[model samples]
Target: MRLRVFEAYRAAYDKSPYAVAFATCFVKGGASDTLAQFKIERAESWDVLRTVKFASFSGLQTGCIQHFFYNVVFTRAFGPQRTMLVAVRKTLAECLGYIPFVYMPNYFMLKSVFNGGSSLSEGLGDYVAEISGIMPNRSFASRVWLLCRSAGPLC
Candidate 1:
């Protein structure tokens, strides 16, 4: 069953990167959010709306853009050569360029746009603090990325 499922996913990914990426990202986002709610909020039941909001943001925006990033930007810029320069540049560019400029802002926007809350204004500081909580791991993760040399930041 597991092998069959893996084969099916591999076929889907080979057939349509966009759809596979979107679906995976959608599920990932929802699952991560669910885990967060369970761990942090101590929720007894699932929050379907929050999960949907996360899915929409992750699938429609992040997944699509990330496909371009992995297929075009990272592959073109970094390539498979795996030089120190490539690793350094890719890490810096992804960490500096994408996380702040592209990723987080879009996340906030999507959260605000979908949920219609004060995340932009009043809750901004809270979000920043939240982001700061996971701040240090990025360097290590990027370094691991250098070793793995996977598809993209997400992949």
Candidate 2:
């Protein structure tokens, strides 16, 4: 359940350029430490068992690697000869990283949410409302709105 929500949040952000910025922030601000702290705090607050699940970490790293490979390698390797296969592979790889928890469960949940006629924008709005309760700042709302707008009408 928690993983599904996190994946939804990740997918919402992944469609926007903010993914790059978020990745940069992760790298520049100390990825391991920040992620560890986040896991620790989140686990404590949410009472999540197995807070440092190996599969979850693998999924997160896979997503990071996919983004890096796509932006750095795929763009250069394929150049103007992009194909549907390449795009699908990239998208799948990102999904793997974005939704690490309950692999099949998360995938199906997202598929149902997205394919059931709800717009990505609606999902993002819900995400923003949830996050606002935790962060409670103007900038967070501004960032969410900016990212949603950048993600287009569906997002």
lDDT of 2 by residue, 65-146 (tens): 4455556654565443345555544444434433332343333434335445376455455555555575555577766654
TM-score of each: 0.67, 0.24
Question: Can you give the lDDT of residue 146 in candidate 1?
Answer: 54
lDDT per residue as tens, model 1, 1-155: 99999999999988998898899899888989999889989999999998898887888766878787757788787785656766666767776687666777677666666777755653455457777876666777666755565333432
Worst 10 residues of 2 by lDDT: 46-55
Off by over 4 Å in 2: 1-51, 84-155
Q: What is the C-alpha lDDT of each candidate?
A: 0.74, 0.47
The C-alpha stretches of model 1 lying farther than 4 A from their native spots are 117-155
Give per-residue lDDT, candidate 2, residue 42: 47
Worst window of 10 by summed lDDT in candidate 1: 146-155
How well does candidate 1 match the true structure in TM-score terms? Answer: 0.67
